[model samples]
Target chain A: MTIAAMQGIVKRYGNELALDYVDLSIHEGEIIGLLGPNGAGKTTLIHTLLGMIPFDKGSIQLFGRTEKVFSHENKQKMGLVTQELTVFEDLTAKENLEFFAGVYGLKGEERKKRVEEALAFVGLSSNAGKTPAKFSGGMKRRLNIACALTHHPKFLIMDEPTVGIDPQSRNHILETVEKLREQGTTILYTTHYMEEVQTIASRVVIVDQGQIITEGTVNELIANIQHEEKINIDVSTPGDVPVERLKGLEGVKNVHVDGSTVQIISTVGSGNLDRVLSLVKETSGVVGIQAEKPDLEDVFLTLTGKQLRDGEEE
Target chain B: MTIFTFALKRIFKDKTNLIFLTLFPVAAIFLPEPEYWPLLPYGYHYFGVLILFVGIRLTGLLVEDRQKGVVKRLAAAPVTHFQYLFQNLLAFSVIVIAQCIFMIAGGVIYDHELHEPLLLLILFIVFSFTAIALSLAWNSLYRNKETSFLVFMCVIIIMALLGGIMMPIEMLPDVLEQLAVIFPTYWLAEGMEWVVMGEDTADFLLINGVLLLYTLLFLIIGSIRRMG
Candidate 1:
């Protein structure tokens, strides 16, 4: 079942178009990655879906019904884990989840069981009674997600959930989301990290300027790109046949020389290493070689002509 | 259990509120015991306004929620707007009552004053609810705290003058008194005065009922505007 849908949604803020006629939908079991640059209306779209903001045009539906703009029943069926630490900093993790559970009208044994389940799912059980101030950023975010899920909403909206955390916490959060998806929850996930979408999102939607440019599976996204092979080689002999002969190799696209490194792009995943290696051996140079498959980041860069991280693309 | 208890526990965590709750009302009692107290006319109304100020400080709790980004999260959560507003009202009313009790107790202990506890309780509940509703109203309209505080002070001053807090309705010109009839503060102060000076339970009841009605009105309006 399609859990949520947005059609021709338009949002404006004082002459600025926050979201312009954007169309997207998520299924009951698929985790859709809403990828975008900053100022790209990802948060705005999430806010609109949550009925926290007004849109100038279009329609949104949740669970086959027209959206009620934050109605009781609708809110009860949805969960939000925002980027910022929305959990009460003063309240312990358990207290925060308990408070949210109470707000959802959960009571007595039911609320306690849910809180325990959520805390355990988020791997925050040990930190249950600890205040957010004493917890790390990653732990707090996990608690935030746990609090949001205290009522067990079927649809989840996570906006940049892993903005800045240590590697270990990011890995933990990603793993937890995978577990949630395996349980049949639909997720509208947004992030600047390309690798995150690779592991969890079944498909990726690239949003920019209040609209979706294109969306597809990772393999489909990178399918049409010319250079599938990137070869980074460190050479010793140095200047012989140097750069020109390397670019001339069969299936080799381009070669650039910098200091002690020669970078080569191979057309397709043609195992361009062998031919390049032969040429290098004849030229009395290349020593080290490493080839890697193009991950989603390369695909994203190839499709958008923009880098994932804020401004390092150029 | 109840969200109210959770809110009470949350409010108590601040600790500063507990200190202020006691100090505010006691200080109000001590400020004017005799000649020095009489130096300012209608001192009771000033204390009432001070009580409202205490209420406004409690409203700053919303500021903390905003600062922490909890408001947005709550807005997105499964809880309805009614639940959120009620939670705030529950918390706000608890703190206000805490302060009001200290003031009333100081009246009994130091001033040797005694009136109807039921009347006073009704009046205090109304006052606290109104104060919180007004604060939420200001917060919804103006995101800035200073602006809301300014508007609060202006309203409280206007209320102090028109409602007979500083000057009784009988002393005011007929036209101004008629104008005072429209302000919530007038009702708030009138109810409080009835609780203090009048022994007739009906007068106290009448005044307290009006304030309670105002409290409900503001609470509904503010909650609707904010949550809706």
Candidate 2:
């Protein structure tokens, strides 16, 4: 079943268009990873869905209801974990969860039960009484997630929930998200990290300049660009390597030189590696050669013509 | 917890606020009364400024919420904007009212003359709302808490000084006295004068009415969304 659908959505900030004729649909029990560079409308789209900001035109069907204004009941069915750490610093971790649960109308024993469950889910049960002021960045981020989970919303929107944390905490958050999905919670996750999406997102949507450029599962996205093969050759001196000569090789798509490494992307099954190697051997001694399989990073680079972290914004 | 109780916890979490809440009332009570001033008690007049400062300090939590993106998160929650603002404001009023009670109790303990004690309480309660609104409205204009708060302190002190909280308004230059009405502190000082002098009921009520109007205006101005 479709959980939420945004049709022909249009949003503008003053004269600048933030979301232009965008359409996105999220289904039940699926984790959708939203990928975009800074100022590419990912956050804007989430805000529009949550009714935090108004869209200039279009209709949104949330929980199968097409309503311009989000009702209080509809709001209770969804939760958003913002990119920034927004939990109250003065409030204890448990108290923060209770406050948010109470806001969603969870009362009495139910509120207490959910608060405890959320704290345990985020692995902060032992520190429930400790205020966020003393918690590390990772623990605070976990509490931020727990705050949104106390009400147990079916639809969750997490915007870069693991932006700047240690790998262990990031893994914990990812595992928790997977657990939530296993329990039938649909999620819309956005982040700069590509592997996180490759590991967990059931479907991936790539957006740029206020439009959905492409979307699919990780393997499917990589498969679309699988026709190209990336070859990395480590040379004794990369500065003297003739990049233009390699670019002239038949079926070579692109060539990039970084430090002592030279990378050549050529058409798969083109048999151009020998010519590329011979050309590299002419200038510098070859140290190592690696034939790399395409991944989400390459797919993203090929589709958007920009690195995943290019022009990052706060 | 509800927003009101949560807000109370957030306010009292800082240990320094205890000293500000408890010790300041004693200082305000003992402030020497002016011999020539027959309108308002000198200490009570200064207490108006004290309540205003306390109101501003309490409402700074709201400003911090905006600065740190908690308001943006709250916008996505089930609570409406009205619920958040009203509950936080209600919490602030409770704290400010406690300060008022402390001032009244201090008057009794110090054996100071408090004319029309009930009316004086009403005036303090009404002004507390205005002070919260004014502080909230001031906070809406800036994003940084420290800078916004420091600048607000300077502005509020100037307003109090000019509105006769520090000295008699009649002693000011004629032009300054004419301009004093623009500050809500002026109406607050006027209400104190009404309480002390047993002014007519209609005029006394009008002072309260003007203060409420200022509260309404400030609340509207403060409600503008400044979150990023």
Candidate 3:
């Protein structure tokens, strides 16, 4: 069953196009990882889906209902864990959950039970009385998720939930998301981390330049790429090797050089590694050599001609 | 539990806000009045000044919530925009009424006699509504909490000075006195004066009607901004 569908989404800021005719469909009980670089319209798409910002043209359907304006009932069926810490610093963990639950009209024993359950799910029950002001970065992130979980929405939209936290907390959040998936909750997770998508996403959607460039399961995306093998070689004397000579080797599709290291991409069954090594040995001494199957990062680099974290430093 | 109750509970949980809201008015009752303010009742006049303080504090609370993303978080929940704003307004109204009650108690503790206690109570209630509406309207005009708070303080101080909360309106220069009527604080203070002097029902109703009009106008603008 389709949980939420966005068809032909086009969003613009003045004259700049933020989203250009984008389409996304989320299925029931599936974790769809929305992978993109900075300013790739990932946040814009999430905001549009949540009805935080209006799009120039699009139709959104959630829980099998399409509406011109999202009703409060529709909003209640969806939960958003924003990237920023949205929990109140003055309010304790339990109080924050209670406040959000009350906003959803949960009352009496139901509110208390849900708040307690959410706290326990996030592993913050011991610090339920503590305010977020004194919490570490990881604890605050967990509490942020717990606040969203108090209402128990059908579709959970997490925008980089593990952006800046300790390894333990990140793993805990990932496990919690997996548990939610087991409980039959549809999720749309957005992040720039390819490893995260590789680990938890049932399907991967790569968005770039305001549109989805490609999308599939991790293996499917990797298999769909032209190059099947990535080879890395470190040389003691890179200046001795000729770039044209390496490219001329049989089945060597692309070559990239960075100081003393050389990266070679090739198609499977190419038998290019032996020829390339023989050619390199004649000119320069090889320090190290590695050959492996392509991952999502290699696939993204091949498609976009840039690293996923490029321009993120700015 | 409705959003109103939730928000009110949150506000009460903040010990600083509770102390400021309750204690400020109580402290104002102890300030010695200047003899130059003979045209207005000093006790109610001081209470009127506290009303502006409540307005500033209430506006600050709403603006801080917006800055902290609490409003956006609530918007994503089962609550509608109208429900959110209405609850916030209702909560602030309750706070204003509590402040008024504290001011009344302060007046009694000081052995001050009000000529028309019932009329004074009615005027305070209307004034509370006006403050809530005005605060909401003002809050929608600025996005930054600090900027909104600075503006609120400036407006309240200027209004209190011109509206006779600081001194009698009759003591102002003719031009300043004429310009004072443009402020809602003037109407509030002028209405309270009428209640203190046992003015006719027609006069009392007219003043209350003007304050109500300000409340309605502000509520309309605030609601429009909120919807936008």
Candidate closest to the true structure, highest DockQ: 2
Cα TM-score per model: 0.81, 0.88, 0.87
The regions of model 1 sitting more than 4 angstroms off are A66-71, A227-230, A238-265, A269-272, A282-285, A292-305, A311-314, B26-47, B94-111, B115-121, B141-221, B224-228
Candidate 2 CAPRI grade: medium
Model 1 score (lDDT): 0.75
- For all the predictions, what are the DockQ values? 0.61, 0.67, 0.60
Sorting all predicted structures by DockQ, with the top scorer first, yields 2, 1, 3
Candidate maximizing TM-score: 2
Interface RMSD of each: 1.7, 0.8, 1.7
True contacts kept of 3: 0.65
lDDT of 3 at B169: 84
Question: A62-115, model 1: which lDDT tens digit per residue?
Answer: 888884646778888888888888877768899999988987779999999999
Winner on DockQ (2 vs 3): 2
* 10 residues in a row with least lDDT, candidate 3 chain A: A305-314
Candidate 1: residue A190 lDDT (0-100): 96
* Per-residue lDDT of model 2, residues A177-295, tens digit only: 99999989999999878899998999999888899989999988988988878899999987899888889889998999898999999887789888899889888779999999978
